[model samples]
Target chain A: MGDVTVTKSPDGVWCLCRLVRERLKAEVEEMKSQFSGFRPGLVVLQVGDRDDSNLYISSKLKAAAEIGIDAKHLRLPNTTTQDEVLQSILSVNQNLSVHGLIVQLPLDSVSSIDTELITNAVCPEKDVDGLSCMNAGKLSRGDLSDCFIPCTPNGCMELIRQTGVSVAGKHAVVIGRSKIVGAPMHDLLLWNHATVTTCHSKTLDLPEQVGRADVLVVGAGRAEMVRGEWLKEGAVVIDCGINHIPDETKLSGKRVVGDVHYASANQRAGFITPVPGGVGPMTVAMLMESALRVTLCSLTGGRRHGNSSGVVNRK
Target chain B: MGDVTVTKSPDGVWCLCRLVRERLKAEVEEMKSQFSGFRPGLVVLQVGDRDDSNLYISSKLKAAAEIGIDAKHLRLPNTTTQDEVLQSILSVNQNLSVHGLIVQLPLDSVSSIDTELITNAVCPEKDVDGLSCMNAGKLSRGDLSDCFIPCTPNGCMELIRQTGVSVAGKHAVVIGRSKIVGAPMHDLLLWNHATVTTCHSKTLDLPEQVGRADVLVVGAGRAEMVRGEWLKEGAVVIDCGINHIPDETKLSGKRVVGDVHYASANQRAGFITPVPGGVGPMTVAMLMESALRVTLCSLTGGRRHGNSSGVVNRK
Candidate 1:
């Protein structure tokens, strides 16, 4: 077993993340004592049998249990109706007990899903994932200091903070521009002081842009796509990709690798998040954090955790 | 007066500005056929004597008259009520005759303006200037295929298309991420296929980021802020800055210049929007285009002008 490299970053801001976590622990403890009636619950609906989705769900359930959130997992048949899926979401959306609802994606390619309708149907308050059309608008407008940001990207941010990298004034390169990861990631980085360039399949020169970054995030799911040479010296890296590759050495049929070749990149990375232990862990943690925050706010008459510091705890 | 640089940009794209003049001409010729109709009414509300606001409103009114649109101006006292100002917007919103309404901003310092409420209350369909919150949300969601876009930025885009510069796969660096320009500009660029980098006061290294642009748009309104030396060779520059400096030689007592030090910038630039003949005129033309589009959409069941290749009169 290889222990990952976990060093203090030279160029980023780690103390900020500590401050945020301190505030989170403090706020959650305070809420537990005072929020007598508060019980934050999150319901996740996953369909079919994708190993990735199952892994994501289990981690979320475990995180929810560890934090004081109630996470319920419901698996539906791949042949479920769009109406049935929407009904399940609306049920959780309306259930006062469930503060948030996340409908897991990759619905069978055979059965078309109306993403817009599902997103629009999510109650804005319980949109802890913050993927709803209304919440997306709030983020884009840069007016939502109180809005629930989507988990994975926000998790990337929490990690960035932990690394002690000041995003504001840094050159952050994002590989991929999907609505969930790259697009929202760019906006969040821009909000935090990073000048961001997003690249995708059509990007003219991939390495040139990557060469200029002070911080790099790769969400493009091509295994080992970002080589060690593509990084800026001492640049902080957050790898969000999870690709399963055949490995003869693995106990399982195959092993998982990230978008970057870990060993070589870690040697050059000032701070980097290892695949399974890094962003994957932070995402579920953030979701639990979001659900708990939502519960506290609803209990306190639609107000927030009220930490003037703008940091709240998941646990 | 020194002869100004004029790049007569070719029109007819997703930008609504190009269709305004020809649409207006057609509407005027048909005015007699529908005298009972509202004569395409437009009302503009002004709060103060800010020179720039005066210039913009005057240009709009001049263009409205030339097009035979019912042009009406209401100058409210600097001490206008939030309700009173809102009432004007309300009346216009309710008025069957009025097809478009504009509430000029930066209300006099003597009277605090309720900009948000004003923006929130305006009808999205008639938000010709495109500052309404509703329109903003729609645009950010990539829903502008049916919404009114802010005009000056739209005009900036028309210039690019006129140059036959393909937006797809290009990089756009937008300086000054204000609600009116930067935010919408970012979304619009994405819609058109340009990877966008947005910068504000908090951004780390200004010139370093600016130096890597394929297209640079400066809307900070700071005179000569972007030096000629900062631009990438052969890059197109759109200087949205309109500043007044002491000019003893001019009768107006001051002279106008753009954010770019144009003479120096023009030397290295492949294309640029000059202080007078560039974005300024194109903005009014776009507003007229928006009004005409709004009218046609209303008459034809809220159908938008067709996507980039909108209804255009070649002659």
Candidate 2:
């Protein structure tokens, strides 16, 4: 028996947690069937060993191994030249054995971010991360006819749907405009029929924007960046931030929490995904799903089992 | 020559409009110079005998020819098989002379909307219209790295920017989810940093969605679909609809109006782009622009004009 609401209209209950588990089960089985012996390889390139980035990669590699995927964490020194990074990416892109490639961000930056150079060599086919600008544009236009949507944002949607919030016709506001979360979140919401507003550092009156959202996804890293009073009544809240702030009572002297103050925000939020068990784990799981999807797609004539809503052609 | 807003932001008014105009003028002239005896070509595959579709195709062909772009309209009978229709598209798609290809919509009942088939067959490099699903996704994800954005929607944004409304950090609501306008408009808005919402027939409380928009774009076929009372104060409106409504004053007995009740909406709108002269002409113009862009892109190492804002360096 599931504790969440039925798979129809989201009244007052959240069930996406169960749905996510079910989907992971279904995808694992389906992918296994499609990929009998075709093990996929994932190359995660991280520059300058940031502790958080190291932890994220380590977890991703662990997830990959658990899912029977060949995953590697390619770490380079902070002093590594841009050409060296590009050359390493070129090899991963050119390697026929690799099915998915992801370059971890927050690259040792002093100048402008050269997204073009970093992702330039990534072949569109094995670009499971969808960091490539080409894929970003593809998702924006809903021309998913040949693009890998970024996994985390894509996973966020998948997780939200589990709570049974029908995205169609809803007003969704995504906080933060990072390429990884906010930008792609805007497109995904638009694709699913949610009227989307993306707020960032530049947006005036962030609270006013937040107040209008029927579905609010917060990804800004600052602790409790969104106040409880700003949330709309009965809104579905997805907290994607994993931040560490000093908490005097805690043993480690710091506590991890999401961008939204969950306790105060929960009074009005009809459905909320928790921090430690919420988007953090779902992201890694979804990347596995994407790697599997890449393999299945490369195998089966490009049409997936649940492609589109299958509503239009029913008539 | 410009009506600068003197009340709120004095430091902001720096002949920005004139400066942008000068830059665009130089770019346009630069593009025109590259046309040295280059004959652009557009091939249209029109299935069935729908009078409206034919008229639309003919006008596009005329526009193409007027611009020194060779245009051809091929008529395939209603009874033509899907394969035959597809083959005709292939011929145009493969021809090096045909730089742009458009398959007019509403193909007869016999030929299912195999629009996808025709679009898929056309090479991405020559997909000047950007109707291909692959390119559409690229636009949606805010990645213009290697894809051509859709013509009509691209035009809508240019017209909106032309109105002196800054899209960055504004709230924009787009009506209709048609691939042509609503979808691409949403992507363009996201790319420009406006929080965007997309509404369609399935949307609930549509007026509430419209009221939140700092920028409103209406493309639905229904006349007077958007009410003037729902508009936000000082909002900019762009009407893409071309509905024929009864007008006793007109000699033909009817007149063209947009999705919004224009006369009433304009009272509330700060700057509104008229349906007849506003976006309609620009759509055709953008198609020419797309053709120009793709031609230049194919010209080995040919860089777009000095300010190719089209590029998405997502770092």
Candidate 3:
């Protein structure tokens, strides 16, 4: 047997994230200059005082501000009525200046308003979160022309493409089936001509199925559920899951980890994304890009008809 | 090795087709009886004299009639302008009696009419073919309540459910990526919680991929492209392709064949559907059902708010 060495190279997550962010920032600056007094606006609606939700909202707002986009965070009480929240969404949707709208997830579990109803309330054109039935439907139909793709999945695709790995003809395995991530990811991969297999909680023999993938994307939401040996050698791994686990080594006694056991995956995978530095940054960047796109479309009259030619080249 | 008996069961294409047809007919009859002088109407728009298109239109019209629905076939010349076709679609869409509209496929290839534009022109409420971007998008988002699913994929799902096989957690491999068949089929399977893999022309090692499927759905539109050994033992095969191959033994010099080499597949697959008898009959049955659904919705006044509850339970 010949001796073989597997080099564990960094997947360049930070570099790619910076590149995407810088490009979006440049576009935002250009748009501002092209149209005097034009500022891309985003309204984020948050219900309840959940710490995590507040944290996410602040980060999103900060990111938007950094890119020279005006971001508004609308906070609602946990006991707010369903109609009240919906009315707020409708008002924001009607605002000509507010080009993008997002309802922070994990609303009070007991809230009377249905999550789906609220999601659909946002205007499709300005739905930066891409959770509306209209956007999801457009994405599924392989019509990327006017739809806002969900941020995390869009980011995952961007990262995968950055690796210079051709997605077409590759056996891609996606683990998860959430409407926000797994389902759309599967659709995107299929649209890109990758032979895609989706695995979820119901999937039996997960490891065996994952082993077949040349490109494995795990978003099952469980921390380190996927072990190293489960992945095929030389596989391109993208982890979209972010779960906080107790860690004695950390000062805060907690650490963020992905669905994959990164150490083990790194040993075998040709490319593997780290939990904190990888998909998280990309998600925010994609959201900024989506917001900019909506703003541009609004400034130039109604929705742009064909594929997204302005910023995100889906093809 | 101990002697073991493996009984190859009949896929029951005819039985399932008849069952679905009878149910749809019953629903149509019930609606007719409940609402006096109410006749569900369907308009099929065919843009060419293609023999295959003519055959499909006739079959659809006949099926609608058998179910107590009024159907009209609008034949347009090959030289018909795009504007004329769109105008026809818009007129039929506005008709109060017309509950279903289908633009027959393979519209004159040389014609300048854009198929996508024409398909989208049909009111989503009356688009029985489910080729409209709106219907396709809704179906992809797992929101089946209001959208009409594409007939072939709906038929394939119905057929799979009829077999008494549990689809959840099963590894399903779908061949082809057409918007009408393969793409929607993948979405339906994924929505049903199956581990779905979509293979297309770009796919390498097709046979190996096929071998991994517990359920294999082929719609590549090629005749006998998949052979027996490619399938996993005891695999349930759903062949959606309908191709005519020249045959010396047949009086017509052509015989209908599916994407799979049926004679060989039958030896290994636990259940296998035949080309002519399998998915063909179900497509017409599904169209009749879709028309009835639209008719019922109109009678009830406007689109039904929730999941399809009356006749077609896509779930």
Candidate 4:
């Protein structure tokens, strides 16, 4: 029997992430020299200090520091009011020094603050997280260059690009519909010229759908829900799910896994991304890229202001 | 073999359109009684007088008049500049009497007027055509109740709803991605809980993809492109393409057709919409409905302004 060539792409992701950061660093340095020490700034707005949120924020800050970005952690008390949160966001929106803003979500708050209102309050030009309706609309309508795509999907696309698999005319089946991951991923893939299918909890015969994918991206929160048997032979799989399950083998008592069953999927897949070493690092990396892009556009006076472009250009 | 039921839906569309007009008439009368002879007004701005544009405007005007709406045809000269068109649109926007406004598309002008700019200049609150990015953004985010959906897709959804087929969990294959028809149709279906696959010219194995659809909506603008043999048995098909092909048998030397080959499609489809009489009439009806809805909301002070809702609620 001919040997199956299953390419595991953890190293590929690390290299890609490193290269992006390096390019961003070089660009940021050039901008600083040209604009008289104009340092690109990003503000991470957190409603509460949950340990997980803190961990995410710290990693973002670390990446920003490495890229020579002015990264600030705007942490609010858990007992903060909705108006107070909005006030803080509005203040950041007006801050000339801050070019990018992201609200660390699942707002751990005593009071029920509206997350949508808070995220949308971030100026669209400064919405590096790309969760605002304006950015989401632009992305949905295939206005990729003008809009900020959500970080995780952007990272997933970058990974898919690295696989050297041409997305055009290929069937890409996305097995989630979450705004941050599945939904945006579907849009990104479709705009990239892939025939895209979006499967969700309501989807029937999901395995059948998955089996037809030339490229498969899964962000369904359930750990190891997608099986190896369901995947098409030589399919490129990008798993975005980060689920922690009890593991006696690990000292931390739990280990992170993806939506796809890695060992089994690896046996049949042509290219597969491992959970911890794959999409997670790329998501953080894409966030830095988005921040850098937003800063460059806004500071360089190339920002588009209310210019209406028709979303339907494919016809 | 038993008889295959093929429900041709031209009658249903006519009935739906009439009922909607009746409902709108009654509502306008009620509003007039309450607010001192207040009448809902709609403004259709036409830049130039193309024969098709004139025909479309006349139909819309006729529908608006039937609904007791104060319909005005703001026809500008063919030599009108982009700035002049913008000025006209902005004037209509500021007019408190005008509750709904639509710019008749393909602005047949001597100057190369920006269609996107002209369409978007109509204030979102008064944008009955629903071509504005603000409305498009809201619709994409599944804010169905708040956003004005583009007329054609909204009409198609109504037709599908009339068929008594539950969209939720069904496999819907949309064969085009035009903003006015296919793209919005996909979004509407996705939000309504259908698993949607969007296929365009880039789609390989198109027939195989078509065979899997429980529900199929085609707006590819190609005359009789989708054959019946490719369809899933008893699929609900909505054809939005209006194309004219040469027919020697007809006196006009041309006949209208849809994207689907209707004669063959009728044999397999449980429900199918016919061209010229199906989606065409419904689009006009939906435009009138949208205008009425916008007027009711704006004049009654129920319109929402500048609310930032995140598009990703599916998680």
Error of 1 at A194 (Å): 2.0
* Candidate 2 lDDT, A11-62, residue by residue in tens: 2223443444456456656666776756667889888878888888988898
Tens-digit lDDT string for candidate 2 (B157-236): 76666556677778888898777788777767767777777787867888888988888888888988898899987887
Against the native complex, each candidate's DockQ, computed on alpha carbons, is 0.42, 0.37, 0.65, 0.64
Off by over 4 Å in 3: A1-11, A248-253, A299-315, B1-11, B109-111, B248-252, B300-315
lDDT of 2 at A136: 67
Q: Compare candidates 2 and 4 on TM-score and give the better one.
A: 4
Residue pairs clashing in model 1 are: A12-A164, A12-A165, A13-A164, A13-A165, A14-A164, A24-A313, A168-A193, A169-A193, A169-B204
DockQ (model 3, Cα): 0.65
lDDT of 1 by residue, B114-175 (tens): 68678767787778877765566556656657567787777787666666676677777888
What residue runs in model 1 are displaced by over 4 Å at the alpha carbon?
Answer: A1-29, A45-51, A73-95, A107-112, A248-252, A302-315, B1-20, B27-49, B68-76, B83-101, B108-114, B132-147, B302-315
- Binned by DockQ into CAPRI classes (incorrect, acceptable, medium, high), candidate 2 is acceptable
The sequence of per-residue lDDT tens digits that candidate 3 reaches over residues A1-315 is 011122234447877777877887898889878997689999989998998888888889988888888999999999988898999998998888898999999776445778888898998878888888767776776776667788888888887776667778889999997888898888788777788898889898899999988888988999999999988888888999889999999999999899999999888888888888788888888888888877877878756332322123543
Per-residue lDDT, model 1, residue B62, is 89
Best model per DockQ: 3
What local lDDT score does residue B245 receive in model 2, on the 0 to 100 scale? 93
lDDT of 3 at A98: 91
Displacement of the residue B214 alpha carbon in candidate 3, Å: 1.4
* Index of the highest-lDDT prediction: 4
